[model samples]
Target: MREEIIVSGRNNPLIDPLLHVWHWEIPVYLFLGGLAAGLMFFAALYTIRNRENNYKVAVQIAPMFASIALILGLGALFLDLHHKLYFWRLYTTIRLASPMSWGAWILMIVTPISFIWSALHIKSIFPNWDWKFEVIEELLEFFTKYKKVLAWIMLISSAILGIYTGILLSAFNARPLWNTSIMGPLFLASGLSAGTAMVIWISKNHDERKRFAQLDLMIIGIELFLIIHMFMGFLASTQVQIDAANLFLGGEYTASFWIFVVILGMIVPAILEGLELKGYKIPIVIPAILVLFGSVMLRIIISYAGQASRWLY
Candidate 1:
């Protein structure tokens, strides 16, 4: 008898019919890290917005965390590139039509803007009283004069960063799991949720608690609505799309999607925010940590599973 053979290559029918090579781990890491950085940017922006100086300490510290996330995100993005040497060419050519290209450009713009804004804001808090370099003094003075501009840029960029990350995933229409028009808005809500949650959890001062709680509730509601819309859209989609949805809802990614993303990221946060809004402070900080961890895992699972399955009927 002839030996039986098992084939699972490009010619296999059960395999992904459309083979678009992916750099997987790096892209998913970038997605999660970028959103985390964006969330921190929003946290900083909110501190300035509320005219709350007590919150400034947390805001200042947040950018350090954001900086780490952004650096790791950029590193992942760079690693995903096949030709790392020609990466500079992306900056030279601005293609508005391409979301990946546009996202790269927007991220590039936001990162430095955030860094400068964070630096100026920090300088405002810790003023250099040394009578050493006149140039440094003059520069600091200049920054003080345009502090409002920096704040505005920071706020606007936070918004852009929040949505841009989702748009980056939605750009791939072939992947029905990520092609939701609601994703951009959903991402913004989730970013705000994570951002405000972080600020609240890290806050030493009790004065800003109410405002952070309010922000958390607002973001949670919006996120819930967007998730509903996303699911509805998916359920109403074509066969291929439904197949894609199964990959998350009932397929391989079900556990992560339900446990981490839905239960922890959404449900726990909503309940905690609700209690917070009702002025019930029975040590609600743990839920905030849970939600933050859930948000990170959600990004990883969604990015990974959305592209992991085969779409053949």
Candidate 2:
């Protein structure tokens, strides 16, 4: 005799359970991408302005970090790909509909530009380095001569790269939490904030550090507003969107979402920076470290929270 087994659909949740498709590499990539874009953007802006302090950390050291950060971020992305050996296929064709395609092209364009941007400052960075190599001298001379043009290109590319980081996640309509158009601007603001904090951390010039600290405070304010608006938009959206929003508000990710991202990441950093701006001699490193750490946590929380969200029940 054969026995028949039946499965009860009614006992299961309405929608398929959220799958953990993405992992730590993705969020780390996003955070580093944003940081790199921010550094490049600020560096280009300072170059264009021909600021007297253009050779400061923001313009000099930051671009080098931008290049390094982007390389690491791309490495993380490559590792996340299942077909790592076939990664070259991404360049073989253009798919307008695919965010991954857009990201790959953007990174390809941005990476070389970032390296060239850093090369422009190589002479200033390593004043004692040997310049006997013709190739190195020529590359340096070319970048220095066309610095303005390169700065403009970097400015535009940085903005695109920063916005692309957000759009990459937003493109996933399957995750309502990441579907909002606001993600682009929000991430851009966060990137600028984190980048500003990073420059502040490494900057030796007192005035420059103060200026960046003020800028970061404003960016943090904007980020906070965007966060509020994001949740408000979710509340006004469909049932699926509301359910997705709850994943952060009252679901599994609630504690880390509030503690790590909202409080420690944005609010505390804002207060610390604010105190410093108010003539209080707070340790700049403290806030800078908090902002950078918060930036990373924000990306991690968003990545996991988005993965936990779904459009259907």
Candidate with the greatest lDDT versus the true structure? 2
**Over the stretch 1-313, how does candidate 1's per-residue lDDT look in tens digits?**
6663345544544234544455455445544544555555665466567664656644665665566667777877888777889989988888988877877776787777656656655654467636377886687678768776766766777677778777877877877888887878877677767777777776766666667777777777777778778878888988777887888777988887888888888888778777767778757587677767766766777677666644443
Q: Point to the candidate with the largest TM-score.
A: 2
**Residue 120 of candidate 1: its Cα lDDT?**
54
- Which parts of model 2 are misplaced by more than 4 Å? 1-17, 52-55
Per-residue lDDT, model 2, residue 227, is 93
lDDT of 1 at 134: 84
Cand. 1 Cα-lDDT:
0.69
Output the lDDT of residue 180, model 1: 80
What are the per-residue Cα lDDT tens digits for candidate 2 across 73-126? 999998899888999999999999988898899899899998887776776778
| Cα TM-score per model | 0.83, 0.93
Worst 10 residues of 1 by lDDT: 12-21
lDDT of 2: 0.87
